[model samples]
Target: MLQACLNGGRMRDFHPALPFTATEIASDAALAVAAGARELHIHPRGPDGAETLEPEHIAETLQAVRSAVPGIPVGLSTHWRIPPGGLSRQEPIRRWTTLPDYVSINLIEEDAEDMIALVLGKGIGVEAGLWSVSDAQRFVGLKDAAKCLRVLIEINEQDIDEGLRAAAGIQAVLRQAGSTLPILMHGDEASVWPIYSEAMARGFDSRIGLEDGNLLPSGRMAGDNAELIRAALALAPR
Candidate 1:
């Protein structure tokens, strides 16, 4: 599946086309889906244009995007930075009047176990974000690793050689752990297409968008998320 990560832990200064509001997200989602994105990853923002976990913001974002692009599964990045961790981070999920189809949580973060249990306990699917071999090992130790919706093998390494090496390291860990969970592998700015091609060649799910990069595979600045998705689909191995 090609998931479109619309906007990540970033603000408007990153990209003017970045979608923060529900309206913008929904519109971009429609175009991206038409361009071949099967799943949506977004960072719903507040009135002040900052990412917010407030139930109201989540509810509105989910409702608007889901309503606009009916049938597309929409998820959000549950970053600890939003509320700066502790009970504050977990409280909103507990108080959510509206829930997303799923959420991607950074497994490397503190309190991740508690957060995973909470989201799972709520019956919402969890996408574990594993950044390194150690993170993959940590996930393997979980008896419930198989229950996760998917494991995101996020290679943040920008250098192509190092990024692929990181991917290999984590894959080795997951193999040793006997994890059968689905894998969504991807990278950022400089390594996006290389990693996407790797994921495609290996038949694993991959994601792309402004959050990960604003440039197209040709090194051109993308006009919007749709352009990126189109480029990503075109880059797939035949």
Candidate 2:
């Protein structure tokens, strides 16, 4: 599946077209879906334009985007840095009146297992984010790894060759651990398109959006999330 990561933890200064509010995110989501995005990934923002895990902000973001693109699975980031960890990070999720279809939680975080269990207990699916071989090993060690919706093989490495090597190492760990979970591979900035193409070539799911990059594979600046999705689809026909 090609997931659209509409707006990550980026501020408006990062990109003039980056969506910040519920309405803006919803509109961008609809456009992305129209351009062939099957899933949605977003980072909800508070009134101050900062990423927030507050229940009200999350509910509003989910409602607006889901309304705009009904039937497409929508996911959110549960990165620990949002509230800087501890009970404060988990409390807001517990209090969320509206839940997303799933969420991505990095396995490298301190309370990752607890967060996964908490969200699962609430009946929300999980997308385990594995950034390195160690993170992948950690994910496989979790008793609930099989219950996750999928595993995100995130390559933060900027060098294309190194990024692919990192992805391979992470996959090796999962394979050794006998994990049969789905994989969604992605990279950021300079390596985004390369990793995405590799994911397609490997027959794994991939994603694209302003969060990962603002340029097309040809190095031209993309107009919006929809344009990015279109370029991603053109990489390989499904």
Q: Write the per-residue lDDT of candidate 2 for residues 1-238, one digit (tens) a residue.
A: 9999999998766678999999999999999999999999999999988899999999999999989999999999989778645557998999987999999999888899999999999999999999999999888999899999999999999989999999999999988988999999999999999999899989999999999899999999999999999999988755
Q: Which residue pairs show backbone clashes in model 2?
A: none
Backbone N/Cα/C clashes per model: 0, 0
Q: Candidate 2: count the clashes.
A: 0
Clashing pairs in 1: none
After superposing candidate 2 on the true structure, give the runs of residues whose Cα lies further than 4 Å from its correct spot: 84-87
TM-score for predicted model 1 compared with the true structure: 0.97
* Tens digits of per-residue lDDT for model 1, 37-143: 99999998889888889899999999999988999999988887885355577888888878888899887887777888988888889899999988888888876
Runs off by more than 4 Å, candidate 1: 84-87
TM-score of 2: 0.98
Q: What is the C-alpha lDDT of each candidate?
A: 0.89, 0.93
